[model samples]
Structures are given as structure tokens and as C-alpha cells.
Target: MFLDEHTAKQQIVAFAKSIFDRGLTSGASANMSVRIENAWVMTPTNTCFGFLNAEELSVVGLDGTLLKGLPPSKEFRLHKAMYDQRPNDRCIIHLHSTYATALSCISATDNSNVVPTFTPYLTMRLGPIAMVPYFAPGDDALAESVGKVAAKHAGIIMANHGPIVSAETVESCVYGMEELEESCKLALLLKNENANTLTAEQINFLLNKFKK
Candidate 1:
């Protein structure tokens, strides 16, 4: 069932608190959003998720105009960019989680897929995670870069930033973000250990079967 606007606000606050409480994100370093009808409800700019006020969440038009509540997060463009490109995506969760942020800072010649295929759940939830080059916080270019890959990928790690994941529901988006962070942690743990990763064929089979 679709959540009403009021319930959606409460759900956003609840999920935000959960994210902060579980250490999925800390401080005011993350943003979240859910599309409702023609507008989007989002976390306010610079507000700590742990202490979010349900009434203070921002509601904005698809064109980015602020309609109610506090001002939208500075990363609003980032969220809008993804939504503009992918009609199927309804919720977005952006977090500066510990391990995922660490992986984002790694210098890589090939910045294609940062998270290796270490688990079936990761593959099913996040697909091929892409990497976008660094752009200063609030830069529109960051949004543009994300838009380029958002259609094909369910999640992406911004260079020197962190990850942003979009899914059909807020719950699924949070789950995908968690899967991404865990996969990144696993990748770091297995570094230089010659860990066996899923083969392309195996990954393809999982992708075909799950169709996340």
C-alpha cells in the first residue's frame, strides 16, 4: 500500500533515526528522499538524522521548488537528478557510512565498479555500483555526473564522498545501502588475501534470477 504524505513524513524520520542509530550514517552528512505523487519529501539541509523532527522535513516540487517545511538538503540536486532519469526509482538514501566512504577515497585507475561481487545479496540489491568523480559538495556537476550513470545503476559512490542508492521503496533503498556498505567492508577486509569472488557467469545467473 502507498503511504500517505503524513505517514511518509513519519516513515522518513523513523528511517533516518534508524540509519543514525545503527551507525549507517552520522552527523548531518547524509540525505534521504521519497517521491510522493508529483513532489518529493526530503530531509532538511544540515539536520542530523538522529534528531530529525517529523514536521521539519522538506517537501519540494519535481522542479526543486521548496513547497513546505525546512529547506531541502544541499544534495537535493543529486536526488532529483536520479529521479529525473529513472522513473522506476522512488526512494533515495545517501549516506557517508564508514566503510563505503573509505572505499570511495581509494585511488583507482579504473573507477568502474568499486564494490566487488563478494555476495549474492550485494549483487542482487546494488547491481554494478559505479563511481563518479569528485565534485565539491552542492556542485551541480555532481548531479550531472550521477545522472549519467543513475539510469543503468541502482547505486553509486561519489568520489571522495559516499554512496547514494535508489530503489522502489524507502525500505529497499535502505537495505541496498546497507548491502553496499557491508560489501565494501568485506572488500576491504579481503584486500591482499586473494579472496575468491563470484565469477561473471555466476553473477550473471544471480542477476537474471533475482532481477532486483
Candidate 2:
């Protein structure tokens, strides 16, 4: 069911609290946004997710105007960039989850698809995980980078940062983020061993069957 503005606000808060309680993100490091009608309800700047109140979430217009609540997150542009590009995506979750953030710090030559196609679930839910070059947090350049990458992929990992996932609903977006974190963890766990990853054909079949 499509959530109204009021319900979207409550769901955003509830999702935030759940992620915070589970250590997906801590302090005020991550940000979330949910589209409602012509505007978006987003987490406020410097507010801990565990303590978020529905009224305190920021509501921003499509044109980037703050319509209500406190100041929007510094990374609001990153969220906006994705929304501007992907009209079908209703929710965006950017989190500094432990495993994903740790994977971001690793050195790699190929920035594209930082996390290899290790699981069918990750491959189906998230196409290729784009790895965007590091930009100062909140930089307009960072948003632009995200926009370019998000044009082709629903999930991306910022270099030395974390993951940003956009989905059709808040619930699925949260689940996708969790899958991303777990996939990253698995990649880290098998960094030394010659892990058996999915073949290109298998990935292609999954993509064809369940492309999101």
C-alpha cells in the first residue's frame, strides 16, 4: 500500500529506529528519505535515528525547498540526486553500516561493483553495486557522482563511505540495505579464500528473471 505523508513520516522514523537499534548505523551518521506526494520526508541533520520523532523529520519539495520540520540532512542533495534520476524509487536509505563501510575503505582498482556477485539475492535486489569516488561529505560533486551512478544501479557504495540504496518502499529499501551489508560481510570473510562466486551466466539469468 502507498503510504500517505503522515504514515510515511512514521514509517521513516520506525525504520530509522530499527536500523539504529540493530547497529546498522549509530550516532547521526546515516540519513533516510521517503517520498510522499509532491514532497519528501527526510531525517533531520544531526538527529540520532534512535530518538527520531515523526514531527522532527524534514519535509522537502521536489525543487529542494524545505517545507517543514528542522533543517534537512547535509547529504540531502545525494538523496535528491537519486530521486531526480529514478522517479520510481520512493525511498532512499544511506547508512554507515559496519561491514559495508569497512568494505568501502578497501583499496581496489575496479571501482565498479565493489561487492562481487556472490549471492543471487544481492544480484537480483541490487544490480551492480557502483563504487563512487570519494567526495567531501555533502559535496554537490558527490550528489552528481551519485546521480550518474544511480542512473544504472539502484544501490551504490561511496568510496571510503558507505552504501546508498533506493527502492519502491521503505520496507524493501531496509531489506535491501541489510542484504548489502551481509553481502559485504561475506566478501570480507572470504577475502583470503578463493571463494566460489556466481558465474556470469547465472547472474545474467537472475537479472533477466528478477530485474528490479
Candidate with best lDDT: 2
State the displacement of the C-alpha of residue 59, model 1, in Å, after optimal TM-score superposition: 0.4
Using all chains and alpha carbons, the TM-scores for the candidates as numbered come to: 0.97, 0.97
Q: Score each candidate by Cα lDDT.
A: 0.90, 0.90
Write candidate 2's Cα lDDT for 33-135 as tens digits.
Answer: 9998889999999999899989979999988899999999999999999988889889999999999999989876677777877789888887778888899
Local distance difference test, candidate 1: 0.90
Worst 10 residues of 2 by lDDT: 107-116
- How many steric overlaps are in each model, in order? 0, 0
> Which run of 10 residues does model 1 get worst, by summed lDDT?
107-116
